[model samples]
Target: MKKEILKIALLFLSITSSSTFAQETLDAFLKDQPIIDMHFHITKGYGDNEIYRHLNVDIDSAKLYWAIEDYKKNNVVLALGGGPLKYAKMYAGAERLFWSGLIFPCTKTVEQDKPCEKEFYSESELREIYQRGNFKSLGESMFNYYGIPPADKRLEPYWKIAMEYDIPIGIHADSGPPVERVNKEERPNYNPTYANPELLKPILKKYPKLKLYLMHYGGEYSDQSLNLMKEYPQIYCEISAVSMFLPKEVWEPNVKKLFSEGLGDRLMFASDYFGTVRKNIEIIYNLDWLSEEQKRDVFYNNAARFLELSDSEIREHRKKLN
Candidate 1:
């Protein structure tokens, strides 16, 4: 929690050095809506060292703590959780510390000595975990990976469980070239090309009812993402980390193109805000190509529909119809 707080403080410090933003803009924009951040990460002992090494950014728990406090102060809903499923317990603990909404079926691998690992949990054990915490959705599951194909028979058990619980499953779909040329800087492993729509076609056809999120706008293979959304109303694309990292000149046109192509309603906002930049909210708000209403949908309403928040909650945060 402290880390999030410090990051916000840092953001403010950074901004002040440049120029003071109009206080009214900050207050009105935030007060007018419930900014539910659909993507965040949490874990313990999993060092932030890698971020500094690759991205040259230093992050810590104190920064994240500040971020959360600032979000709450501004009436934002922080959808927080973590994985790597090996350390699910640690992630769960961190979620509670921040009073965050958890994401289930995280990819954290559990060691036998760890509190969370036990080969597999019984139905009761699974139910107990669900009941114990406040999880906003069901996953960060990598359905498409080598050895573990998107349509792999092994995932049926996990799918069945998610269906029984009626939670949204956030799946990883790699929409890029082969991994060999990929680098540590790009986080290559996460972008498995095999997870393309051609691969997931069978899986989606079979599990037609699964509420799934295609992370990263399926990367460079965005058309495949569009097709999936067209085929399945249950499928949504999360535009979080990708938007932040991409060159704005490129993103603005692509975002406009996505809407022009009729994929607007299915696009959801997820900042992937972890121990990283907290000013993304402001950056996104100021994106020039997308009109204010489009920004509101991306940042607010789309997520509200998926999360199924109450009408009253929606009314409280609805962006005014200009």
Candidate 2:
């Protein structure tokens, strides 16, 4: 009986010690690491609160402020903001925020005949916007929600412009959030058929030099995503809101598969919204399966490479974070 008690005690102590060590390692890494949120969104403007509320996430001013504070606390060196022209003005001159020009208007259902009252930039307008040289990236385009395929004619000009100017494009290429949760009306136009990663093959072939990353990695299309990245070295994927939205069983295996397939360098970190930024970072940081180098790549290095930031620029950004 004494021997049994001793064995149990030893086992308990061993487990406790292991857990403590893991926590300490994670804390140390997070404290020293610089993160780039490639998929963040500015949600303080028109109808943004309503959209969050519709998804059952109640976001008041207090929550928003806390989220912003959390970004600084987590050493988020840079955040790529997607949504509204107002977001650009909101974070104008803010060293930490890089605004991407959003071209789509927010609406409840894609089937809505008329566009939402919110203005969407036209091809010409986007050209003028790009000429200003303020937008670093071209998306979080929300094309899937509007039934716009990657090969759609409307996007051809934008693709040309992005390739011509060497702008990185971040596109939403998967179905997220159950339609019932956020859409009141039937959304015939919001089907996942267009969201398949394979649809991007044609565009990639047409513009071989265009830099682009698929957001959410096409929720359930992991195979297609992996194939695309394998075929096209320029293609990358960001694991954003999917980290928080998908079940652990589903999310973990998908991420593990990506790592197993040797796509770690192409996998960038993102936190689609302010509310989930820190949470997503924590999830990725605590992933025991990932090596320290892989974690760093996902959190910062991959983004720096994708955005083509120079060594001096990276050092400067790190200085600002410190």
Candidate 3:
């Protein structure tokens, strides 16, 4: 009878300890941290987009409001958007944190194999469609599947246009299979070779002032991304889907090297959260290898400097925090 009583006490202690630890973890996460999700997407269709479709079956005014509230409840800054270019101005209003938007080069046509449907726009069209008031930067552009070689002359027009406007371009440089399967035997397009830094070397070298963002931890070309970061001080890398997709075992050590090798300030934390924001935030916060200060940069500081916002602006945002 004494042994049974002792066992019950031990179980109670264990449960109490576990509960306390979980609360501690959650508390640490919620403390005074400002999260600016630099890569988020909100489109009208639900489950129709491939990955996110499985997460939500509906997308309407009510659903969007719910989604916005959920993100806001979690202290998310912006939904760095992606979708039809025509709606760029409309979603520009959705940004409550900072002004950022995505321009999917391949979204203009259903034919993914051809060159981008509209490679270069007239000055008037670009201003009308993309340049809505203060939408500061143009995005995480998915270049890998656009079916154009990185070295093609066609990219020059894009370079000139974005450069002319002094806007930074966030490139989706990773390779991957089509999120949509068009053929039974075909594999997804998962190679970042088209964006290998060697191909970009000339363009980058030529247009030294063009602000290029290498997203996805350089995708399949991490080494190349590192080299670009080394060679061009202007180059930056946003850690998004890769951080969330990589398990802790693989990520802890690799991220150390990525930081040690001059990629520290260049690294920005992004959830790539269309569907995975909650999990990504947990994983990033739980990374035992990173110190709290390191996590702070990944969460906020790095992006503030990269985007060149003033100290006053950052402090103003901090003051408005809950």
Indicate the worst ten consecutive residues by lDDT in candidate 1.
107-116
* Top candidate (TM-score): 2
Clashing pairs in 2: none
Cα lDDT, model 2, residue 161: 82
- The residue-level lDDT of candidate 1 at 309 comes to 72
Order of candidate numbers by TM-score, starting with the best:
2, 3, 1
lDDT for each residue of candidate 3 in 272-298, tens digit (9 for 90 to 100): 655566666776677667788887787
Candidate 2 C-alpha error for residue 39, in Å: 0.7
* TM-score between model 1 and native: 0.69
Q: lDDT of each prediction vs. the true structure?
A: 0.57, 0.71, 0.62
Candidate 1 segments whose C-alpha is farther than 4 A from its true place: 1-28, 45-64, 73-75, 84-128, 131-134, 143-147, 175-191, 312-322
RMSD of each: 9.0, 5.7, 5.0
Q: Write out the backbone clash pairs for model 3.
A: 47-53, 175-190, 175-191, 176-189, 176-190, 177-188, 177-189
Q: Over the stretch 1-322, how does candidate 1's per-residue lDDT look in tens digits?
A: 9999999999999988655555456557666656666555544333444433343233435444455565566555536344433344444454422223223333324321223234234566556666675544555554433225655555665566556766676665544335665444323244466557657677666666777777767356577777778888777777666666766665566566678878787777665655433466766677666777877777778877876778876664443222
TM-scores for every candidate against the unseen true structure = 0.69, 0.80, 0.78
lDDT-based ranking, best first?
2, 3, 1
